[model samples]
Target: MTITINRLLLRADTADGPYGTDIVFEKGLFILRVENTHGKSTCINSIAYALGMEMALGQVTSKPPFPPSLLKNIQNENGTEIPVISSYVMLEVSNDRGQTCTLKREILGADAESIITVYESDIESISNNGRNLFIHLEGDTSRELGFYYWLAEFISWDLPLVPNNSGRESPLYPVLLFPLFFVEQKKGWSSIQATTPFHLQIIQARKRAFEFLMDMDINETVNSKAKNKKLIDDVQEKWKQIYTQLESVAIRLDGKAQGVKDAPAATFDPFKLDILIEHQGNWQSLTSALIGLRADLTQHVKASQPQVAEQKNESLLSKIRELNNIVLQEDSKYEFLLNEISFVKNQITATEVRIENLVDDKRKYEDLKKVKSFSILDDLPVLNNECPTCGREYSDHNVEIECSDDLMTLEESLEFIKSQITTFKSVLNSYKMQLDIKKIELSKLEKQIDKHGADISRLKTELYSERNVLDEESLREKIRLENQITEYEKGLVAVGDFRSTFDILHNQYKHLISLRRNFPEHGFSQKDINKLDGLKTKVVKYLSEFGFSSFDPQLLEISQDTYLPTREGFDLGFDTSASDGIRIIWSYLISLFSLREIFKTNHPGILIFDEPRQQEANKFSFTGLLKGASDAAKSGQIIFATSEEEDVLKGALEGFKYTLHSYSPSEGKILRKLNKGA
Candidate 1:
């Protein structure tokens, strides 16, 4: 599957930041051309970071390979640091099937570790509408179902949890595939993977990733061998654990195996153990010694045991029974106290609620009395010669009625409700006090329960103390010997089982190792050789175009072992100039992207190179580099950040479909400046 990033948006929540910074790219060559020391690296790295590819930026072994802050400070006229608060990066991309997603990640905040959010929508919907219009996949935000793994799955990358050389399994994350896609300005120009050699897992992971991207048939073979090695190491560790436990027990026995040096003599050799057991007399001796110990243990058990007098035994039994009954009754009381506390709390809540209602009613009545005199005027009936309700002439009916008596009665009722509210408040306070007292009593019961538990423990230990004193030394020795003998026998069986398993695994391991040792000479088919030949021709052509003509084409070759270019069958280090070395790297990278048709690879079909002008690269050679990028852009997208002028960019991008995002000191930056009001 091919991934094409349509747009990248970065926003900073600060007055002195680029709040609405956005960069747009089409499916062709794009240049984020800026002046030297401008924000080119920042912008390119932010794009990769947003895609969960930050580990590809700098030294992978660094504590944090990427910058901690995505936002850069912009100086105001007054010269003060206006910090960016909430910073985030959002990338909108689409696959070959036209399925699109927007991956958003917060660059700042306490929840940054858990801040990845994926939205399933087209780029237009995401840009024209808002984030809420899209659908979020289920469980995407959970750590167990990571967003990185989701993206890897979407792109059809086979990421397995493989064990590294250190005997620990590490997840082959998406960043393992990013070394080919991104080039950091700092160390990316130095080496293929600027990492420590001690990091064997990372090195192996890099090779696996490269093989995956290049569509090599040996990728699965390499992974299988690594996993096999890991399994063997795990089994060996298990065997070692069993051996150490047996050795510990063997060293404590009174025999030739009574010391560390002598313990290994008891080490069971699975292959020859049965033969030795019949001829050598160790097992027979161990059996005889165990029989003697058990016989002695029986006699000691009978002789050392003492009989208690009848009177004392009865007294002790009676006391224990009494204490047991008291404990049961106290446990019942403790449960009752817990229930009582819960009931008291419920009663307090009800009383408080009742008081609140009473207060509300009193307040409403007070407001009613305050507005009553004025409301009475508005409510008075108008005198007329007609009855208002029946619409008949009022010839003899009395039309006037007074509400002064009713108002007086309403005022008296308000006063009564006010008194009721005060009474409810007093009752509520009394119930609260009672609840507090019950809580104190509950605390005291808990302490008493704990004290009684300690007493019971002491009495039980005393009851067992005399019986346990019956020649514990001899009994313990007997038990230890028996356990040791049993464990030694099991150890022998385990060793036999392991030997059987290891033999099969060892055969497979040797086969894989032999294949890997002779892989470069015999592994490749004729078709694979033809593709590598094509790749070599392309690499030489690109290198010559990039102004590296000092070396002959025959002298420069690609290493079949590493798939990297070498000079005279050696690595291209110390023999080539800095400029020539970078050119070779450029040629190799461009050729990998250009020859995808021959390999049927999953290269993502995109390239991002940050600042090709580093190491004082000649402008003419740099133009050649840009020309190669433009050529590769014909098949895939090539996006690079450069510090060249507009004239240079225009000349390099003459015969291709491309876009130039120019950044200058005066034109603000990719990030828009905040207005005065903002």
Candidate 2:
């Protein structure tokens, strides 16, 4: 895949002033040159921000290369600065398929919230086009529609959903692709492949990115194994829980607690429990005996009569009726109190809303008063000699009229409005307080009503006690029989649950074991080995061309274990000088870029080098690096930023195919004055 940046726009808002820059690129090498601290890194990072791949820049400090920090504290005249209120990065990009898109992302001051917008347009018509017909990508880290996710798909990188070290699944984001594309000025010199020290997890992601780019299919197996392990652990925990509950149930039924039996070794067999139950006749006998006892107890209850005789009394019944009437009256009062409380609550809600509106109105008027008032003189009506009131031509002295000086100003009007809003808020708050007091009174009334209800219930119970005619011994006998029947039924239920628990555990255990055996261990295949060998050869070739002298090409090897270049079959990454380390990075990444075409890879065909010569002292090797990059330009796009002198660069690569945007302290910086036409 080939992606070319046609234009980049950065718009900034600062307290002192607003300024921005626009750079246009063609199909060739582009060098953005400036002195140190002149915003070269800022220009490169603007592209990453517009693409929503800011995380690829690694950890950001309070300086440039981090788009947010650069925008928040923009530079101004005489080394002064101002806080930025808003900032945006826009880019017009085209792909190998001839599809053109204008992408933009905006940030509001220091806040992290950003709006990502993209517009797909025709390449021929894009120069005069504004990004009006754009779509905003929405969602979060886990969503498929997020800005980063959409960009990855738009570039046709078929990144799969893989499991992280935490056993959580995440989609492949654009940051994962940065190791082979972006070279950070700070950490890019630390390794053959640029690394981020954000966490150990990102280290693992680096390995995953390499594996994915090589077209290895083992990630699916790895993800499946992770998911299977988590499922098995959860199932085992559930089995332990069920065993404990089953033991408690057995003990409650007057049976000795037995340890849960082992799961069956075969497939889940629901009939196994049925065969066991048939062999044990105790359960059947217990069920039969409980049923017969229940029938006898029912008949005895039906034939029994009251042990003591009662004499009817009209006066006692009348007193019971009077107590019942008091209960009904108390219930009515309780319902009324509840309704009144609800009504008061609604009234409070309305009053609070009114107060909120008034407060907002007051704030608006106060803000309006602080702003500078518009001058009426700037847009005064155009007057001519025929503008006389009677439609007759008149002289300037005759048409002259005096304006009043005592008119009310907007500030005075705003002050009156503010006072009225304050007064309305005060009245609304007073109403809310009054409603709260009413709610409190209603609560006390409800408590009193409950006490009256309890008194009525006690009276009814006392009246019923007087009417009870059964002997105490007979009541005790009936209660004992009922308790016996309940215990028998509970025992039967416990026996049934014991068998059911065993069946469910047996089924779940068998299913989990089967799933575990089906997932095989994932290892690299022959195709992976062949790709690694090809990458190693390319690395050796490019390293030699880039002027690295220490290691032999035959002895130089790419570590399959580390996916990093090794010297003499040993890890020499830390032993090498910083300049050599950068050379290794250059060779390693450009080899990947070359192999992408050989392997038909999805690399987006763009590489960014902020300052490859930052730590190197030798200018000769740096020129060779530039020469190699120019040769690779036939395959993709390379955007390089440097502080090296122009004449030296011209002499080093005399026939180099590239473009230059050089700047100096007196000539102005990369971030130029804002365009008034934009």
The number of the candidate with the highest lDDT is 2
Candidate 1 C-alpha lDDT tens digits along 420-533: 778877887677756654555555556657755665575556555655233333355467556755654654454455456444444544554555465454456565567667
Candidate 2 Cα misplacement greater than 4 A, ranges: 13-18, 60-86, 107-112, 122-138, 141-145, 192-203, 254-522, 556-562, 566-571, 664-666, 674-678
How well is each residue in 1-678 modelled by candidate 2, as lDDT tens digits? 667888887778665556777788766567777777777787777787677666566654212245443456666655566677777777889887787888766644432334566677633344544432211233433455466555665676767766666657666555676767778676666775555434424326776777666666555665666677777666667766765665455434333233343334464443332111111123234455566667767876785665433322233355457657765775776687677767767776776777677677667767655543445433323233464356665554544555653545667766765676677667766666555444444454455467555645654554467555544333544675688568767766765776677677667767877887877544556666777888998888887877786656557788877677887567766556667777788888888777876775667777788887866638878888788888876778888888888887778779988888778768666665564555
Candidate-wise lDDT, in order: 0.63, 0.64
Which residue pairs collide, candidate 1?
none
How does candidate 2 fare on TM-score? 0.60
